[model samples]
Target: MSFTQKFYTADHHFGHALMLSETACARPFASTKEMDECLIDCWNSVVRKDDLVFHLGDFSMGLGDAARVESVFRRLNGRKRLVLGNHDYAKANVIHPTLAGLAWDAPPAAAMETIDEGERVYLSHYAARTWPGQHKGSFHFFGHSHGRLAPFGRSRDVGVDCPDTGYAPRTFKQLVSGMDLEPIVAEEAESFAP
Candidate 1:
C-alpha cells in the first residue's frame, strides 16, 4: 500500500470509565470495555496499517497503568501521530513515544498548520474563530467539544463523539464531501450580526 490516505479523529478517551457514564458526553457504550472495543473496531475497520491517522488529542484517560495504555495503542491501526491533549500525560510519552510518531504536546487552542488535499488545514484540540492562513482558505479540524459546539467558518469538530463522524476516523475526502459548510458560514455571519 502506498499509504497516501490520511484520517483524523480525537477524544477517544480510552480506558476512561467516565466516558461511559451518563454525565460525560453521553457516549453510547455500556462500559469502558465496550467503548474501547468499539473504538478499536471502528478504527481498524476504516484505517489500514499503512494509512496515516492524526489523533487530535485525548487519546486515553483513567488508565494509570503504563502497560495497559501501551497495550491499547498497540491494537490501533495506521501510522499514528498525536497532538497531545489535556488527558495525555508524560508517562504516555515515555511508554510509547515512537509508536505515536510525530507527537507533540500542544497548548490548548494552539494551531499547527498542514496541507491536506492540496489545501491548508489548521489542526488543534480546540476550535478557533480564525487561524493562520484562514484568509487563504485554510480549514480547521478540532476535538475537545465532543460535538457540543457548532462548526464555524471552515472549521469543524473531528471528535469521535461527533454525530456525523460516528466515532470513526474520517478522511479528508469524506470531510470535504460530507460536511455542509453553508451552515457554518451562516453561523459565523450570525455571530457577527448586531
Candidate 2:
C-alpha cells in the first residue's frame, strides 16, 4: 500500500560544513559552529510538530559530525525520512529516527517506490530531472543548488525548489495534464544532475 501526506524538506547543510566556502567541490565547512546555528534556525523555523520532513541528503559533514546534528534533529519534534546523499558516507554515523536508511548511489527511480502512488509531493537533497512518460506524472521536491535558480514564471515546474519559498508545489493533476510549469522550470536549477 502507498501513503500520501503533506511533506516538507530542508537541505539542512548545517551551514554547509562539508564544503569549501568559495568553491563548488566538496570540502569541510569553515565555520562549523555558525553553520550549526543557521541550520537549527532554518529547520526550527519551517518545521511544525506534526510536519513530515524528508531530509533530501547532506545532513551533516560526515560520520563524526552525525552525532551533533542527529542530537539536534532528535530534539526537534517531527516525522522524518532520509535519502542518503554523497556526503553521508563514513563510520560512527547514526541514522535518524525516521530515516528510511542509508542509500549510497542509488537512482531516484528505485527510491520513488518509497513515495505513495499518485502522491504529488517529493523531497530531495539535489534537483532531479522530470521522469518521462508514466513516471512524469509526479511532482519532485528537491534542494542542493541553494537558491540559485532564476524565476521564470508561476506556471513552470522546472525551477521551483521548495514550497514555502514562493514557488508553488505542482500537483499531480498539473503534471499529467500538461499544464505549463514554464515559470517553475525557468527559475529551476539548469539540470537535474542526479
Structural similarity to truth (TM-score) of each candidate: 0.81, 0.53
Q: Tens digit of lDDT per residue, candidate 2, span 16-100?
A: 5444455552323357676555545655565556655555565555444445655665655456655555555443454433232
Clashing pairs for predicted structure model 1, backbone only: none
Model 1 is weakest, by summed lDDT over 10 consecutive residues, at: 101-110
| Cα displacement (Å) at residue 175, model 2 | 15
lDDT of 1 by residue, 1-194 (tens): 56567899999988888877778788887888899999999999998877878888888875556666777888888877776666664463342343243233323223456688887888888887767766556788989988898877678889999888878999877776655544334455456657
Q: Tell how far residue 121 is off in model 2, in angstroms.
A: 3.5
Query: RMSD of each candidate?
Result: 4.6, 8.6
